[model samples]
Target: MTTIYLVRHGQTYFNRYNRMQGWSDSPLTENGVKDAKRVGEVFKNIKFAYAASSDANRARNTAQIILDYNLANPPKLVEIPNFRECFYGYFEGMNSPETWLLTAHQAGYRTFNDLVTNFDLDYAKDLMHQADPFHEAETADQYWQRLDKAFEFLAKQVSFTSSDPVLLVTHGTTIRSIVGRYSSEKQFDLTDPPRNGSITTIEMNQNRQIKVKDYNKLKI
Candidate 1:
């Protein structure tokens, strides 16, 4: 079995402004630094056998802050491209509300919440991809194709059978996608977004069944 501690990266400047930040890099806000520090404190005593994050600087920077506070010897952070946030194509960096409204209207939904709650992350991605004028946004298949390989990749890079917990810091949407798709809990809604710097625990059994033990938690 493999235990994975998934942490959403700290809040970014784009997040502060309520912008569509998928695949668009943004520096961490002031509070974001504090958020990382708090997570570091929460995990100070735990020794992580492996540490990784999406290639985005926000995730890397947050991982560094948490590692900085670790007293336990932790492995160096690894950057994984598959762990990146869903690419929004032309909607990147645009106002979050505006883009959501546009997509929602096109999808025959009254609101973003309604659209997401009724459908799923994959549906959201497909809608956004279709809405993109240049068709640059990641389709549902394209998005999952990369992310579905993530666990296998990490299991190979880290010791899947090891007893130690693995740290994986990534963006909010990426975390949401994983939980919405693989979480054993059937009641979990796709519209429910994870908080920045939150800890979510997921386990993969020998049969590769993914179960989410916790979601959007402030502490482990």
Candidate 2:
């Protein structure tokens, strides 16, 4: 069995402001840095075979902190852009959730809760289409395809053995996407999203079947 540690990147100013960060590349706050250090200390004993992070700085910084604390000579930190947060399209950097609701309402759509709770991919696709009427960003299909490719690449890159563990530092949405692909849960809970600096542990057998051992559980 191979154990994968999926760590959500630490808090950011965007997080505190209730903004849709998406691909904006926000930096971690001071609290975020401290949380990352604590997370590193908590996982100091485990030696990861390889550490992977999203291309975003938040994720890269978190991965670096963890590796720096644990290993004298850590494995190379690979940046995978495809594993980025969901593309919020026109809503990027928008701090007003109410504004998003208004835009969606005018576009014949309900709130994000409606799409996320109903697991309505069609609604999500429509929202993406309507968000960028001029089409500055990728379509929903394109985003999904990108995530699929990222997962394939990571799986191929990490030749995991029973003795080795893989660490992935990424965004909450990216982690949710991966979980949705394997798990039976159709919709994520909107009321309580994954907490910052939390870890979700997953175990995969030789047949590549996944078992979620823990979710949103932080050692520190």
Candidate 3:
């Protein structure tokens, strides 16, 4: 089995402002830095065979901070552009949650989550497809295709042994995408959101079937 530890990057200025940050960039907040450090402290004793993050600075910096606290020799950090957050197009720097709610309403959804439970629409798949009356966004299909290829590549780097876990630092939506698309967890809700520096662990068999061992658990 291959053990994968997925971590969302620390909070950012955009996050503090409740803005949408897809493909856009922001610096980490004071609390975000502290959260990253705390994550490092939590896993200081565990060694990873591989560490990766999206090409975005937030994810790269978080991975670096965690590695600084790791007791073992850190592996080289790999930057995968495909692992970056979903591109929200015109909504990139807006209030992400608010935009979702408003746009969902425009799309005849009570809320983005309403699309899931009521309309049978997957937000991840349909966000870019909806008529936002603002700007075009990345369709859920495109996002999934990107993630599928990226994770497939990363999984190849993971050793089948359980001895060393792989660390992946990425954005919130990206993390949720990974869990939603690959893991066996059916109740995974992107609306609930993941806390900064939280960890989610997934175990993958040789066939690439993944079982979620943890979901957004913040031990710190």
Point to the candidate with the largest lDDT: 1
lDDT of each: 0.86, 0.74, 0.80
Candidate 3 per-residue C-alpha lDDT over 1-220 given as tens digits, one digit per residue, 9 for 90 to 100: 8788889999999999989897899999999999899999988988888999999999999999999999998888999889998888877798766776766775566565776555433463465456545546778778778887887888777778657888889988777766666654456765567788999888876666777777798862
- Cα RMSD of predicted structure 3: 2.2
Query: How would you order the candidates by TM-score, starting with the best?
Result: 1, 3, 2
lDDT of 1 by residue, 1-220 (tens): 6788999999999999999998899999999998899999999999898999999999999999999999999789999988999999999999988888888778788556877777877788888888889899999999888887876687677666678888899988888888887875455665668888998889876555788878898988
RMSD of 1: 1.4
The global Cα lDDT (0 to 1) of model 1 is 0.86
lDDT of 3 at 48: 89
Error of 1 at 62 (Å): 0.2
User: What residue runs in model 1 are displaced by over 4 Å at the alpha carbon?
Assistant: none
> Comparing candidate 2 with candidate 3, which one achieves the higher TM-score?
3
Clashes of each: 0, 0, 3
lDDT of 2: 0.74
lDDT of 3 at 96: 63
